[model samples]
Target chain A: MDSVFVHKMWNDHELSKMINQDIPFLMLSDQDGSIGKMYGIYDEDSGVETRGRFIIDPDGNIQGFEVLTPPVGRNVSETIRQIKAFQLVRESQGTEATPSGWQPGKQTLKPGPDLVGNVWKVWKVSEAFND
Target chain B: MPEEFKPGCQRPPVKKIDPETAAGISNESVLKEAKPSMVKVGKPAPDFTAAAYGQGKFVNTSLSEYKGKWVLLCFYPGDFTFV
Candidate 1:
């Protein structure tokens, strides 16, 4: 897809009316798929990358990344949730790992203090946690 | 014509089909016929020195040079395709 064609589409009366403001965008090409392979997103069978997206911090640490299989679109809401969760953790004292199905404003158990007790309390029903 | 065809067609089937014997062979036994060499991860990746277009000229780049920063080496069947 050409940027010129996108710009032309955006300039149309119906499309222009939907946008209330301008957004900054960056476009980089992976001609030889060097970066794609580095991130482990390149698929050899299709000769194209799987639908993978990464949110890397300025310091080059991968804050979050998601690889969606073919025939599935990315979940924008989940990505935004991850970004917010990461930002919140960065702001707070960092001593916790988010459990499965974790959400904001939930009780985050600190790993160092009473890990066994916490695990028993959290997963009382699991057979692995029993003894 | 019938006598000529009968003489030409009369022969025992050399390849015999044994369903019971064939059924004895398990999936794992069949797969063990050939073994493939495995590459260990976390051990150093294979190094290759290739002529790369860098700094406005073609120069040789090796895996040993980029030891500190993570290096992503990719190989395509060929260039000019959307791989």
Candidate 2:
């Protein structure tokens, strides 16, 4: 857990150089690991939180999450893609489902009995890369 | 055995709480203490209010303030680490 001042300096020094701009979102400080403890990412031994991300939906329910160790870097774009998928499914009231590696303006499966075994035919691997 | 302390005489009356109602986990802090583990999917994301450094200034923010839109909480190990 970092103090707010440390978050400020990190953004100013390290993050800005990588992203070429100040991060335009909240870099919250979980001092004393209260929030991290709540999310189960707090590392008591290190006095820091492990790498993790949580996607909370509009209704405050946790829709998705990723918890990883320090060795691997988490992908922000992948999280964004999943968020888009989640929004699409929620918007369609769970009727539509984005398949693996689904992107916007691509085909979405209408989950039903008809598409149960026939998904292989309707969803082609080529389509994933076509558009 | 200590004779003066527990001589089986002049003892104060015991006070008791109802075990059913005062199971101790009924309070939220107790609940949090009991389950200091993972956040579950479809469960309400833990609400938090904290100071944040964002967009050139320090401001106080909370998870509940962003209730109407999607929220991504990114947590890393430390401030100056490269990963």
Candidate 3:
């Protein structure tokens, strides 16, 4: 996992200490903001980056990504949830696709030629989970 | 005495840009040139190498190192700043 910050490495350490929790992931300092520029999140005027999150599959393909304004914070739990859902779908070899708000131990839909345009008839949204 | 709570007490002032300056700031065109031509879902992620702090050590790493594993790239504005 990558955590890119538009600051110096020293600031990264200081922030980590301020948070009182060790950042568990690899934290990169894009001081020149080149990475941010490449990702299309760099704000040239302010010399800062927007909050961007990308989920990549095992094959290095981007499975999903979200970009938020700098004033908005991202939801870590939601990111984890998406990772879990993506992993499950990848493990199933594309045979199954998770429905909206799907979680572990929930029913997954099997996508096939026959299941097209008839998903609602086979799977009931109310009966899928207790959420 | 209890202190009164005010919303946006610490919020920064919004920057005001003139119409002419704002119109000249075609950020989209600059971003398009900097970004990869084909950046989207199912496309290979842009690769880069940099020094990272992790596992209690500073090590040079690259996106290629995480091949064959699920990876999440989280980019934020700055350190110790409110999102």
Work out the TM-score per prediction.
Answer: 0.46, 0.78, 0.73
- Which pairs of residues collide in candidate 2? none
TM-score of chain A of 2: 0.87
lDDT of 2: 0.82
* lDDT tens per residue, model 1, B1-83: 42332222112223555554678865554534232222233244434344444222334555556554433232222222121
Instruction: Write model 1 residue lDDT over A1-131, tens digit each, in one string.
Output: 11223333433433335564331221233545544565566664445555556654333345555666544566666676566666666556577655545556655556776786667676434332212
Over 4 Å off, model 3:
A1-21, A125-130, B1-38
Note the chain A TM-score of all models in turn.
Answer: 0.65, 0.87, 0.78
Question: How far does residue A107 in candidate 3 sit from its true spot (Å)?
Answer: 1.1
Separate DockQ for every predicted complex: 0.02, 0.30, 0.35
Q: Give one digit per residue, the lDDT tens place, for model 2 in A22-112.
A: 9878888888888999899876655667788999999999999998875577887789898999999999999999987688988899999
Pairs that clash in candidate 1: none
Superposed on all Cα atoms, model 2 deviates from the true structure by an RMSD in Å of 12.7
Measured by TM-score, how close is model 2 to the native structure? 0.78
Which of candidates 1 and 2 reaches a greater DockQ?
A: 2
Models sorted by lDDT, best on top: 2, 3, 1
Please identify which of the two predictions, 2 or 3, would achieve the higher DockQ against the true structure: 3
Error of 3 at B43 (Å): 0.4
Worst 10 residues of 1 chain B by lDDT: B4-13
Q: Give the TM-score of chain B in candidate 1.
A: 0.49
